[model samples]
Target: MTFPAFVDLLRQLYVNVAEHEFALPDKQQTDSRVSLLTGVHRKEVSRLRGAGAPVRVVPDSVSRTSAIVARWLADPQFVDARGTPLPLARTSEAGEPSFAGLVESVTRDLRPRAVLDDWLDRKLVEIDDEDRIVLMEGAMVPRGDGEVRLYYFARNLGDHAAASVENVLADAPPFLERAVHYDGLSEELARSLEAYSREIAVETLLRLNKYANQAIQNDPGGSSRWNWGVYILTSDATSLVAEETPENKNAGGETA
Candidate 1:
């Protein structure tokens, strides 16, 4: 952020924090009270009061819908021997888990019908003639929804950066943060590798997700949030170049 913009943001933040933190239980939120608490000038506080609150874009944690879908894709009870998600009855039978079971496993506090309706509305799952629900997509990548796409963009990127930072700042054994890079590849080779890597990454993530869920269930300690992701970017060689002229010398200090 530019100097002026950052200063403005800090002022806004002070006002917001003061307004919330110093709020009187029996009385209204007063600018004078906020000014005294936050050390912001009363006039500035009054001016910023008309301004909006500080913007906060935190990573989205796993929702009930996402948890159910992850279990559907990972849990053995929800899949066949071939490792495919089975078309499941709404309710379980004879100790077997079903679609409703999946939802309940994630959250018993919520009504299973609400989850089912949400998935149906999002077109993430389908209903069969017997009222069984079938998985239409393997992953919970949102589609045809601009707002949801933006939400995922913030959530996924924020978590990814946080994980990387955590690994880097670790005192003991750090979590894994590894990547492979290659350049000067033929277009055909690049395409083939991209496809192969995608299949391997997807399968590995699904397998790990299954194991993680089981581990969470078995752990005696309370639960914590965890997430990992795989991504790939491929670009041609020309995108890296900068035009060289008399004003800017080439790599060897020779003008081009």
Candidate 2:
């Protein structure tokens, strides 16, 4: 199957895991995790894995699979559709940020778009979230160190909410070098970020969606209403209102 198609299948598996907390099947199982999740044949899954196609596997079996799906949700390709690579996200050698950390920073700060632009400017990292969910996959490499890689998945918190989360991340602790970034971001980096991000977003969104659905269900009747309308006022909107009534006039009989 095509790479994009494979990525989509992996995404569905991630959603299933997030919604149900589905444990991956053990290696001893007759069917591979991919087949069980996608109804694809185990042999096909094996072939794909051998061919460097990303396959889903148990955490314990990650090393065994040649082409395992990333644990996070970020797409690690630094290049855009036009093949333009984005700027990197690291600020200092000791603070080389992985794609995962960048996502965390964006989520924490709530300014994903700005962060994306910031990443573009650095030309060291690349991010893509055009999908229903945001996926950030990339790598980081300190000048003297090996590459550190990352994968991340984030919910599409609308433009406004994402911006808010980005603001939070900006103030959070920096990503540690020992964690993921060993080399500059690469394709391997993309896979890793995608895997990680998918897992987190799926779990978080499921809970949120459940609560929202429950709220709607509990308020099925038309008894509740909220006032959220916007009103356009005249230029002197505040000045139009008198502070005091005629009965409460000042000693001079002037309105307060």
Question: In order, what lDDT does every prediction score?
Answer: 0.70, 0.36
Model 2 is weakest, by summed lDDT over 10 consecutive residues, at 145-154
Angstrom error of the Cα, residue 54, model 1: value is 11
Name the runs in model 1 displaced over 4 angstroms.
1-62, 93-96, 128-131, 145-148, 163-175, 221-224, 242-256
Residue 106's lDDT within candidate 2 is 27
- In candidate 1, what are the lDDT values of residues 139-233, reduced to their tens digit? 36666665455456544555555556566667752656666665556788778878998889878987887788777777887545566887877
Candidate 2 lDDT over 1-256, as tens digits, reads 4798657545543333322223445534233655675566667655544444122222322221101112122223422443223344433235543443444532454344554454455343444452222323332211211111111111211222333434556675332211222222355655676677566655564344334434554575774532111111112223445564555332222110
Model 2 error, position 105 (Å):
17
* Cα RMSD of predicted structure 1: 9.5
Best by TM-score: 1
